[model samples]
Target: MNSMPKYLLMALALISLIACKTSQVSTTPSPAAGMFKVAILYPNGDDKTFDMDYYEKKHMPMVAGHLGSNLKFYEIDKGTAGRTPADKVPFVAIGYFYISDVAEYNKAIAQNRDAIIGDIKNYTNIQPVINISEIRQVVGNNTK
Candidate 1:
């Protein structure tokens, strides 16, 4: 048997093993459910004064501390390349919060309502577009 074929077989086996290990790790939500996701989207192409660094570093941590294990934050940057007749090139930011339920989500917001509002004011330099969503199902991971 050629050495090349032997090396190829070894690599294939290693890849398969890694894939199996990853698949074995579950990503399903835990039975003791206390999680939700919040998504925040910002306007497009304005580029006026949106301090993402401050929001991620200072504001998010503060909010997370207030909420504790009940919440998780996910942020996404959505900036388009150019402008168009339909306002194509928009600089957008999305933040997702994972909390327990609607009531808890509301409570968390209310608790940090002032700080949240202030952070938004400071970061965006303009009113931020806000949206709250309920997570019906998570495709992967079941742990926490």
Candidate 2:
């Protein structure tokens, strides 16, 4: 019984990784001026596992709902490969959020922290590396 969740998690992870082909290129509109960026990177590890299906279908939507209007945009990226051919996939996945108000975002996160943190176990076991930054530049096609 205990193994069932683990098996499902593993299967979801494998399917996600396989579906995101490394050779493909994707583009998103450049962040608007002054937007704050929040990056949540789930580093890969020997024992770490992630269920992308749960994260994409359930967890992220829940978070967006919790965040409400403060969150302008968000994306969930499945790590396919590293920069070099020999390098390992650095992160299992990454969640990116573009927000308008830092204070409001913080407040929302604080209010929903328990529910958000509690759901982590359903999708992933790794601790994510989080970075909040100011969008400084935009150079690519500003289109989706």
Candidate 3:
């Protein structure tokens, strides 16, 4: 009777340990879970007028007020070598915003699409190609 109780307690402890391990794995964010929407805007030419003014004055304020979200803009100076050669690289401007829900994102885009389009038309001489992308953060890198 004593041996039976000892074996049962050991079995229960093993089960509890396994459950805890599985729960930890399940709660962690997967590679796909970290995916976000990204937009890339390329300049028409060497024109600094549109890019500079739009970012500093018009676009930044409007995005902050309307979307209640901060925007991160990057100028693609150095290309990714074999992946994206310098010669092939367009004068690229990349914008990133956090979007957790697709439905909410689409709704916001719809609401502000026309205003953004108009602003681009008035400010930029070169039409920008907007590309939608799914972005995943690289592991073990300090993005902050």
Candidate 4:
């Protein structure tokens, strides 16, 4: 029996957690209901280092290229401060991509898993929390 690759397995696990939640915040209005969303959260800590420059400039573009047309779009959130001035930051950075199809995403991941997984070391050592979800609704200024 062939077991799933470690990276793919982890992605599947994270995707199952929030299959119906919105992770993107924008004025472009929601990209229709049931949109597949992938969110990667890099949890912050006392000794962690996340190279924002590399992530924003290099890694994400590589991801987008690999994701190709199935990737509707993506967003990145850089942590500035916590809930309050004295609190610790929850995450160093968060990367979210609105995928057009889950199956295609999986297929792409299967082919490029090594390249994607291997690039993590260039930016941060922290294991990111991945969430694959669906957009249920859009509230606030984003709603139609």
Judging by TM-score against the true structure, name the best candidate.
2
TM-score of 2: 0.76
What ordering of candidates by TM-score runs from best to worst? 2, 4, 1, 3
lDDT of 4: 0.88
Question: What are the Cα lDDT values of the candidates?
Answer: 0.68, 0.91, 0.55, 0.88
Give lDDT tens digits, candidate 2, residues 69-141.
8888899899999999898999999999899888998999999999999999999999989999988776767
Q: For residues 75-123, could you state the per-residue lDDT of candidate 4 as single tens digits? A: 9999989999998889989998898798999888889999989999999
**What lDDT score is found at residue 59 in candidate 1?**
72
TM-score of 4: 0.75
What are the models' TM-scores? 0.59, 0.76, 0.50, 0.75
Q: Which parts of model 4 are misplaced by more than 4 Å?
A: 1-30, 142-144
Task: List, residue by residue over 1-144, the lDDT tens digit for candidate 3.
Answer: 789999999999999999998888444433344455545465534654355556546764564354544223222332223334545435444454544554665667678988866776555565656665566565666788
- Give the per-residue lDDT digits (tens) of candidate 1, residues 1-144: 689999999999999999998888667533223355666667654456677787778877777777765665445564655466666655456666666666766787798898878767767765566666666654656799
Stretches off by above 4 angstroms in model 2 are: 1-30, 141-144
32: Cα error in model 2, Å: 0.9
Overall local distance difference test of candidate 3: 0.55
Candidate 4 steric clashes: 0
